[model samples]
Target: MSKHGFFQITQKLFLRDGDKFLVMRDRKSGLGDLPGGRMDEDEFFEDWYLSIKREIREELGANIEIEVNPKPFLIHKHRVNEGNHPCVIIGYHAKLIKGKIEMSDEHDFMEWVDVKKYDPTPLFTEYMLDAVRVYLKEYA
Candidate 1:
């Protein structure tokens, strides 16, 4: 948790298997979301990518590469409570490169769902669903 104005980076990974996009799922919540995490005060974007890549590798064991896409599909600004404790999330697209998924403790399991029938559950906030819809449209 860095006091820096910005502290997180999100990526949209499109895992292709033959002619399909591989969307991941949460083990416990069972919601499809991007592979991303927070950036420390000492870490930059590149460092964040490496750290998150390692995390994704460890969590899902998926071969992932950071896609050079500056444009974020959803730049959501949300706060559960107005306090000094600031919490925010910014999501972007980062397509998958290679590798198979292996669930980690962070999630109960994972899923490679079809984009056409993609649906968000109660676990995912509206902001996250916004990002998914954007990806489905562009890739579908």
Candidate 2:
């Protein structure tokens, strides 16, 4: 990795049900992404699990029950805010324990896509798809 710019650390959820994974269309980028965001400045690194849970509750509503892995499933390096803006994405795998999804204003669209059937190209990054594939091989 190049030390060319500042890093924007974010946690992303890869919520899965059987062969399907939950993805939300970003309002700003008009691209599919996991339902998560940057942790607050005051938040501690030790609270990653709780922080993601809070984020999911806020973005997906309080009615849903999701079980997240205690540790991150994958990490990806990408450029946002154009092409050279450095970002480190920490991805976590989650399973929906109960309740149907309800979208919040943060995202414009939400869908459950079957990894084997869905064409993730152009919609998601290669790193993301690779991670999901690894996850599926392990859990699916």
Candidate 3:
């Protein structure tokens, strides 16, 4: 694998429904993470909001409408593919405005977690738990 490149920015959507936030079981890893993906190279809407919005539609279905908070709540940095490439993960808070989730094949399962009380051991990364802590502290 070639390793020469800039950091890949991924937008993680923290979708809130009342007191719970959504998490998806990654098909490849089996660990839970926020619903989102890599940011596309966009010229018009360079911000991650549009990229995440598109991701939500593609992952959750086109019928869903999301209202993403203007600013990102968290920023995490890590290496991808076992250090093959660097990555920067931006976490955003979004509210589901309409439509029910239509799970894509990308993930094996989905869950709504009450981060304040739920155990986070099932999540993929330490950052995932950390994200939850921050979310609960700020939003809850």
Candidate 4:
């Protein structure tokens, strides 16, 4: 293994409500992102579900209950801008099981988008666009 040993692992949720999917504009980056974050140091890789739930609770709200699919539909590897560190993003399909959306400071705006009609190019990164394409072709 290289000195860097491991890549940062991030879990993203494709939270769908009928025909639309949730998208949020990050407060810091000013870029659109899916609802999720990097796995914490204390989190076990095997317990991705719990990590995802925790991320959702933190980024969205603790009152929200999202049913995340354990299997990831998309995975992408890239270097994050923050530290020029290699990262792996795992995307999963999810549904809103309960509660209302209460935005956290992490995001500035939230919207439900119909991928078929919306162009993600302006708001998201290429890797995120790749996930959107996969979602449209296979899952949507």
Instruction: Tell how far residue 134 is off in model 2, in angstroms.
Output: 6.1
lDDT of 2 by residue, 1-140 (tens): 66656676678888888778887777777766788776676665567777787789889999999988878867877555345456777888888889977788878988888866666666666555565556556655
Off by over 4 Å in 3: 1-5, 42-47, 81-84
Q: Against the true structure, candidate 1 has what lDDT?
A: 0.52
TM-score of 2: 0.80
lDDT, residue 48, model 3:
52
TM-score of each: 0.59, 0.80, 0.82, 0.88
Candidate 4 stretches greater than 4 Å from native = 1-5
Candidate 2 clashing pairs? none
Best by lDDT: 4
Off by over 4 Å in 1: 1-7, 11-14, 25-32, 45-48, 62-97, 121-123
Quantify all predictions' global Cα lDDT against the true fold. Answer: 0.52, 0.74, 0.76, 0.82
Write out the backbone clash pairs for model 1.
12-93, 12-94, 27-108, 27-109, 60-102, 63-98
Which residue pairs in candidate 4 have backbone atoms (N, alpha carbon, C) closer than 3 angstroms, thus clashing?
none
Q: Model 1 Cα displacement at 76 (Å)? A: 4.0
Query: 2 or 4, which is superior by lDDT?
Result: 4
1 or 2, which is superior by TM-score? Answer: 2
